[model samples]
Target: MRFTSCCGGAGAKTLVLVGKAGNGKSATGNTIIGRRVFESKRSLAGVTSTCQLETATLSNGQIINVIDTPGLFDSSVEPRLLATEIAQCIKMAKDGIHGVLLVLSIGNRFSEEEASAFASLCQIFGHEIADYMIVVFAHGDLLEDNQCLEDFWGPNCPQLLTDIMAMCGKRAVVFDNMTKDEDKISRQRKELLSLVEAVVKNNGGKSYVNYLFEALNMSEMDLIDQTSEVTCSEKSHEGKKFHIKYEEQFEQLIKMVELRLGECIMRLEKQLAEERVARLEVELKAQAAQTKSKEEMIEMKERLERAEELSKKLEEKFKNAENQSKEKASETIWSRMGCIIM
Candidate 1:
C-alpha cells in the first residue's frame, strides 16, 4: 500500500543522518548544512556522540534542517546509551523527519554491521521508515577519476549495499566532502536535495512523523480495541461504511508493518550470530597456527641438542685413537735407538 505523508509541508525540511560509527554521518550532515555545524573528524568511533540539529539556507533560499545523530550500530556504545541517543534524535525530529540520510563511506568495505543497519532501524522506527530513507555515500573522492557512482555498483559491489539502495527506492547521492571544487560540491548538494524533495513529493508533501511511530508501538490487541470503538462510533454516526473500511485498512497496515519488523529483527539477529561465529573461527585458526609454529621450534631445538651430543662423543673417540698412535710411534723410536747403540 502506498504510504501517505503525515507531517511537514513545503518550505523547511528536516533530514536525519544515521549510520555506524566512522561512516561519515557527521560529515554528511555538515555537507548538507553547507557548513561545519557538526563536529566531524577521523576516528575509530563516532565523533558525534549525541544528536545535533543545525539549519542553513541555501543559495536558492531553501532552508534545510539537518540532524546529525550518534553512530547507530557502534560496537563500543552501550545499548542503553545508544537507545538514549536515538531517543534524543527522535525528540529533535519531533516535528517530523523529511528524509533519513543513511550515510556510508564509499572507501570502506560494506561490513556485516552495515548490512544489519536498516533492519535495526526498522526495529526502532518501524518498517515504514524505509520510505523516507536515502542512501548517501560519503568519501566520493575515493572514486577513481572519471568513475561515476554507478561504477561502484558493479558485480563486485556488496549485495547488502545494493539491497539497501533498492529498499530506499534507489535514491542515493555521492558526496565528496574532501573536494574543494565549488561547482562539484554544489552539484552534489543539489542532487541530494533533489532526491529528498522527490521523496517528500511522493509522500504527498508530508514528512514521516511521531504519530506513525506511536501507532506502530501499539499492541495488536490495542489496535483491535481501538478499531472496534471507532467502528461502533461510526455506526452510531451513520458513516459505518467509510470509517469501517478505513479503520480495517489501517489496522491491517499496522499488522503488516509489525510482522515485517519482526522478520527484520530476526534476520539482524541471525546476521550478528553468523558474524560472531566467523570471528571465532578466524581467532581459532590464528591460535592453531601459533601453536604449530611453537611445536616446530621445540622439535628443531631437540634435534640440535642430539647432534651436539653425537659430535662431542665422536671428538673424544678421535682424540683417544690419536694418543694411542703417538705412544706406539714413541716406543718404536726408542727400540730403534737402543739397537743402534749396541
Candidate 2:
C-alpha cells in the first residue's frame, strides 16, 4: 500500500478517522484539517480503499495530522484487504496517535453493522482504544434549528450508540460538513480539537501506541533478517528468491486476530451456557422446595382429621357409660322403697 505524509512537524497531534462506508469519515477528516485534503463523496461501495495522511496548521498555528482510513466494515471489501489497510493505518500512526474519531452519519439509521463497529474495533485494537476514541456524528445540518445533539439521544435512541459514547468517556461532537459558514466551521473545528486535547490530557499527555504493533515491528525486522541470511546462503538459484511483503505480514496478523476473536466467542458461549445451567438449577430447587411444602401441609391436615375422629369416639363412649350408671342407681332405689312398705 502507498503511504503519504506531508507538512507534519514536532508535537503534531495525530488523529485517525474510522467508520463504515458512507459515514463521512473522509469529510470529517477534511473538516478537521480545515481543507479538502481527503476526498469526500457519496458512493455505494466506497471511496477510500487505503490509508492517507495529511497535515494542516490550525488557526492557532497548532499542526494537526489527520489520517483518513478506508471503511473499516465495508462489506464489499475483502477481509484480507481490510486487514492490510488497517495495518497501513497503524503504520502511519506508528509514532503515536492522539485520538481516534469514530465518524457516524446522523441522518442514517444505525444498523447492526454500525452497532458492532466499536466492538469490532476493540476486537482488533484491544479495549484500550476506547480511552482515545471520540465519537463524531457527521451531517449535523440534518438537525432541526431547535434540535441539538442530545436530541438524537432520546428514549428511542440506539442502545449501542449510547454504549459507545459511554465507553469513550461520553466525549462526542457533531459536524456539519455541508456548512460553508466560516464561523460555524471554525467553532466545530475548535470543539473537536478541544476533545482531542482532553483525550491527550486524560492519557497523561501521551499519545496511544499499541504494544501489539511494537511486537509486530520487532517480528518483521527479525523475519527480514532471517530471509536475508537464507537468500545469501542459497547459491543454487539467484533468480528465484524469497521475499516477504508487508501484505503477507498483515495477513498473518489478521489470522491472529481471527483466532483471538474465535477464542473470545467460544469463551463467551461457554459463560452463557454456564449461566443458563445455574439459572435452571435455581428454578428446579425452588420447585422442589414448593413441592415439599405442599406435601408437609397435606400430612398435617390428615393428622388433624384423625385426631378429631378419635376425640369424637371417646366422647360418645363416655356419654353411654354415664347413662347406664344412672339407670342402675334408679332401679336399686325403687326396690328398697318397696321392701320398706311390705
Candidate 3:
C-alpha cells in the first residue's frame, strides 16, 4: 500500500542513526548536519540511551531530524538497554521518522556482536522496518589501504555485510568522514537523497515510516498456517487421511486472521516497556540536573510525561514478545514432531 500526504509546504524528514558505539556514527551526522549536534566521544556507549534529538535545516530549508542511537554492542550494558533506547527513540519521534541510517565502521570484522545487535533490531522493528533503513558505512578511511567497499566486504567481512544488506534489502552506501573530499560526501548525500525521494515517491509524497509493518502481518499469518499445517499433518497421518491437512491449513489461516486483533494488545505492551525505561531515564536525569533554564525544565517535564506513557506501553510489548516466543516455541516442538513444516 502507498502512503499519500496531502499536506503542502515544509515537508519534514527524520533520519535515525544507529550502530555499535564509536563507529563515527555521530561524526557522520555532524558532518552532514554541518555542526556538532550530537556529542561524539571515544567511549563505547557514547550516545547512551537515545536522549539526543537534533534537527537541522538543509540547504533547501527542509527540516531533517537526526536521531542518534546508543551503541547496541557494548558488553558493559544489558541487551534490554539497547531495546529500551530504540523504543524511546521511536516513541519520541512519533511525528514520523523517515529513515534509519544504519552505520558500520570500515575495516572491522562485522562480528557476531553486530549480528546479535541486528537481530535485536529486527525483533524490535520486525521485518518491515527494512523499508525505511539504508546502510551507512562510516570511517571508510580504513578501507583506503585496501580495495573498494565491495572487495573489502566481499572478502573479509562478507557474512555480516551480506546479512546487513539482506536486512536492508540491498540499500546502502559508504561514507568516509575523514576525507576532505566533496565528491565522496556528495555521493553519500545523493544516495541519502535518493532514498528520501524514493520513499516520498513510493509513499506518495507522505512518509509511510511504519509501512514495513505490512510484512509483519504476512509473517504472522505464515507462522499460523505453518503451525496449523504441522498439527493437521500429524493427526491426518495417524488417521490415514490427507484431506484433513488442507482443511487444517484453512482453519489455521482463519484463526490467525482472527488473532490479528490481539496484535493490538501486543503493540500496546511493547510501548509500555519502552515507556518504563524512558521514564526512568528522565527521572534520573531530572534528579541530577541542578540549574536548568526554562526550556530545559520544560523538556525534562515532557520527558517525564513521555516516560509514564511509555512505561505502560513497554510492559505490553514485553508481554507480546513473550507470547510470540511461546507461540514460535510451540511451533518448533511441532516441527520436531513432523507436524509443522516451514
- Compared with the true structure, all predictions reach lDDT values of 0.77, 0.78, 0.64
Worst 10 residues of 3 by lDDT: 256-265
Give every collision pair in model 2.
none
The predicted structure with the larger TM-score, 2 or 3, is 2
Model 1, which residues run further than 4 Å from truth?
1-9, 210-267, 274-342
Off by over 4 Å in 3: 1-10, 42-49, 73-75, 145-147, 182-184, 203-205, 208-342
Ranking by lDDT: 2, 1, 3
CA lDDT, candidate 2, residue 90: 71
What digit string (tens of lDDT, one per residue) describes model 1 on residues 52-168?
Answer: 889999888888989888877565665556655665665566667889999888878888777777777866676778889998889888889988878776778878887888888
lDDT of 3 at 31: 67
Best by lDDT: 2
Better of 1 and 2 by TM-score: 2
- Report the lDDT of model 1 for residue 149: 78
Give the per-residue lDDT digits (tens) of candidate 3, residues 1-342. Answer: 333233233677877787787777888787667677777765554654564688888777877777777775455665345434544564456556577788877745576566655655555455556677788888777775646778765655567668778767687777777677777676677678677667555545555434333333344456556556665448546344334543454444434333432343355457667879999999878866744566788999999999989997999999999999999999988888885453
lDDT (0-100) at residue 288 of candidate 3? Answer: 67
